[model samples]
Target chain A: MRWIWFDRFVEFESGKRAVAVKNVTLAEDHLHDHFPGYPIMPHSLMIEGMAQTAGILVGEARGFSEKVILAKVKRAEFFTLVRPGDTIRYQATVDGEVTASGASTTGRIFVGEEPVGEVDLVFSHIDKNMSGLEFPEENFVFTGEFQALLKTYRQQGGAKVAL
Target chain B: MPMSKDEIFDKVRATLVDALSVDDDDVRADATVMGDLGAESIDFLDIVFRLEKTFGIKIPQEELMPRDILQNPDYVVDKKLNAAGLAALKKAMPHADLTNFEKSPEIDRLAEVFTVGAIVKFIEAKLASK
Candidate 1:
């Protein structure tokens, strides 16, 4: 999957929680089609941003051995709309141990301390061979770019994992 | 010179409520941390951290959860907790109330025994030993 939602990790504490930022800009392709004129950020994309933040946190806690996927969103509520030039910050906290099969987390979105959204997300893990087809490691989306981005974020004083 | 059971329970209850973000009334003696009180695995670590800070005690991870012992093939037969494993757990965690746990325990449900009272007892025993 493309790591499109979050831009960088602001704070990460492994096995506990994480904070990431997503910058919304008018130059993005999604903003044009989401609305012909108004151009408000899509809530679904916001949720995906939160999920990606939580997913990385969960994966790091498990030493990146398991393939984590979003299973369900138990709860999601948005109090405000996001627009271009507004940076959305997501804070995700793991609710439990990230087992090989499943895990759960809670995420909240903010714009400079103003709470805009909150979500309770459940995730499922599948083995690399679960689909009976083996793809080379290089074919995966979490490759050089992702690692470089994570490294940059880590230099910002974020923990190695999620929190 | 350890805390009274009531005192221990009060502290444990507070810790659970704070860590799990559950209501104070929900953290009862018989309330299971995962089921009734809505605590997940990550919350256990938070709870342990809080307990360590509150009581000034250090609880090793292996002793606190014993994941290795629980998952060992020799200690688990056909996904059920073997007698030897159960006995070892009983000895290791004398503070927890496992009286209601099944004789042939399901591996996943083992964490259910970590109720609010169980944590209180664990802290009580740890403080007394120190």
Candidate 2:
């Protein structure tokens, strides 16, 4: 199973905000073993979904030049449990200027039109923040798989989606 | 109207509480950000972001923590800051009180300089300059 969380970007505004959706289904092996009889979408994965949604937004804001890594989960609070057949909508907005060192993002998670949770995250441009550390030359964070998702979004009429 | 030191301290305390998930009482002025409040390396970034938002200020990476000095061969010698390094650090962070740090300039103890009070002073200076 691939590590990609959300299905696709539904709405994207460069340097500002992006929205993505994910459909929960029992076909996912983790849901089956999570409770056996009572299957609810794991909160941890939901946070991951939010991270992917916000993380991509942050990475794209900088033209994917920096290896944007999720540095911290500032806040994650869920109001309700998500179940199979529910479509999770992740709306992420950049909280402030995307500095060379790092950026902070505020996110809202919704199942259909009703709000289910919120996940606020912080991402570091590792090259700028990790002063003494060294990472690979290539952009490992935004691999082909992640970029393909953005390409798919652009092909699906997200004309404003920048490369 | 300019905010008083108490007001700035209150706001900084709140920011530290949110960023570090520590109790309100734990955010005393003398508390070291990493040692007493338990802030990891990444948490410093988070705190900087929060401080920027809370105070409506732009905090450059070097201004808050001059990691470059630690890595500079001329500034650091045998894991300790030389006289030149101490002067450079002082120039970099006028907001921080380096009296105690000056006595023994070990690189390891650099984190001790960033106490909650130091942050309040930093913000006070930034706001005053504006």
Candidate 3:
């Protein structure tokens, strides 16, 4: 299964905030075994959705130069279960300055107008922060597929977004 | 007015509690951040972010951990910090009490230097400098 969680970037304000939407469906294979009858969306996947939403924002802030990996989930609290047909909206905002070492983001998940969860994440710029470790020279974190999401967003008249 | 050591410690304690998900009682001054508080490398960045937000001060990663000195070949010898490395660490982290670490400068034991009290001291110094 593809790891991409969110379906598309609905709103993106580079370096500051971004909003992405994920449409949950019964066709997702994992939901079938998660509970035969219930088939409720898992909270873990919601966290991954938030991670992708915020991780992209953090990565784009630096022009996707650094391998922005989700280093830590400071907090992930869910208020309700998401089911099939629920449109999960992830709104992520950079908490402060995206330093060379890493960036911190606060995300709010919503199903329509109802608040579902909040996930605070910390992203490390491995190239800059991991002193002794060596990563691949190519920008592996923001692969073509991920960059294409941003490209499509920009093409969709998101011209105001700062790259 | 500058924040006192006690005030700094309280905030630092709260930051660690939030960053590491530890109970308030567990955040003792003598407790090592890694060993006692169970803070991994990633948590250090989380702590830095929270501390920056809490205290409204900038903490360059190097100032807190000094990974550059630890990784430098000139400073490390046989998986331990040589005299030069120890000196560099001491200079980098004046807020940390390295008296015990100085005895055995093993690369592995470096995390022991990051006690709750040491963090409090680091914040106290940073706030004073601002």
Candidate 4:
């Protein structure tokens, strides 16, 4: 699984919340095609980044017993366009109790100290048996790449998942 | 000192409302936490954590829901909870409403009995036990 949106987790607090960062660079293929003269991060990918942040939080809340998928975007607001070299910080907070059907969360996207976007999202939790795929041994909280990034983050003084 | 039933109910109600985002009126004592208030399985952890914080109590994971009971070969048969499993569950969750447990004593169905009142009673009993 390629986690193209977010690169690393800065802080992960088990069931409560998470903070991640994505650094936009000129090498990204999407940026080149998004605009010819003025290449910028597409707003859609920004929303995806926020959803991934919140989805991971919800999945961790359940101890990866359930597959958490982004079901809906309750609300989303954007403040500015993201350009290469800008670092997008995603902070996701789980709202209410994470249920089996899904969880609700609000994510704030920031660049430096300025707020760029915010998203309210709903995530659905599906059990592995219900999803109908033969059970394969895998990390439930994140993809293998993301897990490795988390380990690096932990080594560099990042917060551990409280669980 | 142990809290009064009403005190425990009030705290449990507030915790459910905050954790599940349900209305104050919806968190009645007899209201089913998962069925009526729309709490999902993951919500239980948040509810348990909030209850512990609000009352300053330690609720062990097994005691709270006991999903591990499904692993017992004697307790489970045909991928369902057998009679002995139900009895063990009754002993484990005396504070829960297991009155209709025999109707459908499947291991997965165990979460249905975790009503708000049951949680309050469980907390009360736990506090009293100490």
Candidate 5:
């Protein structure tokens, strides 16, 4: 739900280096009561941010198929704290290819460079209906204007991003 | 997509013994993954990862946690569905309106397929367009 558009995307990328930013605003409901006068991003939310960042990587590695689910968190270390108004950077690498099931994919994640937190995740591309299976969709809500924003940003040469 | 119960169980057993180091005996139908075996949240998650890799499937957030197949004996659990699987769910189900299943009797009887591998094939078959 915290995932933003335009700004939280490939603001800059070149196969290896990519920079995505999430502007922490007081408008966030969590910031309202996190500490009255002080608003610090929760550690877990930081990981979610990392997950979103990593999610984009997976989307790029493969096509942006809705099937890919961030499956596992191999490792994550939090060394600092993320507060409102700060933009966290999620950097990753294509360590190698993973051949599981009957498909081959590149596994990757964000290693927190500045030190707040980093996540080692594995994403799997899957089918929506396997059996009588239904998953919780409450946590994930796509911002309605995401695609439009992406298109608009493309027009602006990826320079202006409103917080 | 409809794999037999024996085949599903065999795959589940392999994931347990091979990936998680759990004994084959511990992976039975009524095995009680988190309830009886003391498998922590992380352990269950790791098992889910093993399932995905082993079966080429993904478990979405909504269905992954509740389907307690290792504990429940009645339901034959399958892999966690992805977008395609979800589409298949919406397509194949004549009563596609799932607005009521949340409160139906199947809620309790529903056996969660904890591992991604165990449920994918089963789900594919189950959700295939009939």
Candidate 6:
């Protein structure tokens, strides 16, 4: 099963910088009736972009050996409206860090140079044994553009989709 | 095995021919997709999706339509594009990297790639060669 969180990680790296791309398109079903005449990338998805980017960081910190979730939003700020045909660029820096249990990341979304959003994100990497849980990947699978999009994830040096 | 430009271009073209319904003669090496083949905005995006599926390559929107790729084909064959076409698709797509990607002010800038087939072929060639 494909995971939507992995879908957003077009690029993920450790210390320097990481980028995630969201191609806002009209075909996304969620965009179906958002005022008909025009479609927009919802603010929530932008926040997800940050969360996904942070998840990558968490995955890296944890050696990607465990499942990770944003777990909490902490703080989120939307700066601009992300529209179809525009690529939302998400970048994150390690604002502060602790052990693998948790870390705080300062992230932002930009449509080109224009800053579209900012997120102060927090994530938890849980051990399945410790959490006593088994979550199906299909349950978290996103549909439409997000699902098709999940097939494409890029690393900065130019990589292939692992899935 | 390392891939060659012609070989990559050929594979990309085959997929485009199927998806965009264009003849081989129409997709020239230097022809602009939006300007030459007459692809609409949706078609261009569809081509992108298909490219992702076919070659296992994800083209970042920004890299797909980079100015130099059309005006100059050599730019598409970047080392990373050759090695990580899918990741390039995901990472290099225009909106994702504001700093490194070529910025376009034209809202209709996307509409300019005339043929979806060509754009797919172009990106595919670049991505496969690495």
Top candidate, metric DockQ: 2
DockQ of every candidate = 0.04, 0.86, 0.86, 0.05, 0.07, 0.01
TM-score of each: 0.58, 0.95, 0.92, 0.60, 0.46, 0.43
The candidate maximizing TM-score is 2
Candidate 6 displacement at residue A131 in angstroms: 6.4
lDDT of 4 by residue, A1-163 (tens): 5655887777777777889889999998888889977899988998999888888788777765566767566568999999999999999988655655566687899999999998877676544213334544564546667667656655775443322
Worst 10 residues of 3 chain A by lDDT: A154-163
- In the predicted model 3, the residue pairs found to clash are none
Alpha-carbon local distance difference test for all models: 0.76, 0.90, 0.89, 0.77, 0.48, 0.55
TM-score of 3: 0.92
Candidate 6 ranges with C-alpha deviation above 4 Å? A1-11, A128-163, B1-130
What's model 6's overall lDDT? 0.55
The CAPRI quality class of candidate 6 comes to incorrect
Candidate 5: residue A73 Cα off by (Å): 3.2
Order the numbered candidates by TM-score, best leading: 2, 3, 4, 1, 5, 6
Comparing 2 with 6 on TM-score, the higher-scoring candidate is: 2
For residues A1-163, what per-residue lDDT tens digits would candidate 6 score against the true structure?
Answer: 3323223455555643567777777867667676477687778767777776766665666545556656556467886677778877788766434233445567888888998888866555443212325566442323335434533433333454322
Which 10-residue window in model 3 chain B sums to the lowest lDDT? Answer: B1-10
How far is A78's C-alpha from truth in model 6 (Å)? Answer: 0.9
Better of 3 and 5 by lDDT: 3
Q: How many residue pairs in model 5 have overlapping backbones?
A: 23
Instruction: Please give the RMSD to the true structure for each candidate, in Å.
Output: 7.3, 1.9, 2.2, 7.0, 11.7, 20.6
Considering DockQ, where higher is better, how would the candidates rank from best to worst?
2, 3, 5, 4, 1, 6
Q: Where is model 5 more than 4 Å wrong at Cα?
A: A1-6, A10-18, A27-29, A98-113, A128-145, A157-163, B1-130
Number of clashes recorded per candidate:
7, 0, 0, 2, 23, 22
For candidate 1, list the clashing residue pairs, or say none: A12-A163, A13-A162, A13-A163, A17-A162, A17-A163, A96-B41, A96-B42
Q: Write the per-residue lDDT of candidate 2 for residues A45-155, one digit (tens) a residue.
A: 999999988888888888888899999999999999999999999999998878888799999999878989999999999999887788999889998776776667678
lDDT of 5 by residue, A1-163 (tens): 2254214554434223344666667888887788788887776666566565555555544334344455656566777666767766655543333222112222222324455565566555434322345645432322336445555766774444321
**Per-residue lDDT for A158 in model 6?**
48
Off by over 4 Å in 1: A8-21, A27-38, A42-80, A89-145, A148-163, B1-4, B18-23, B38-60, B102-112, B127-130
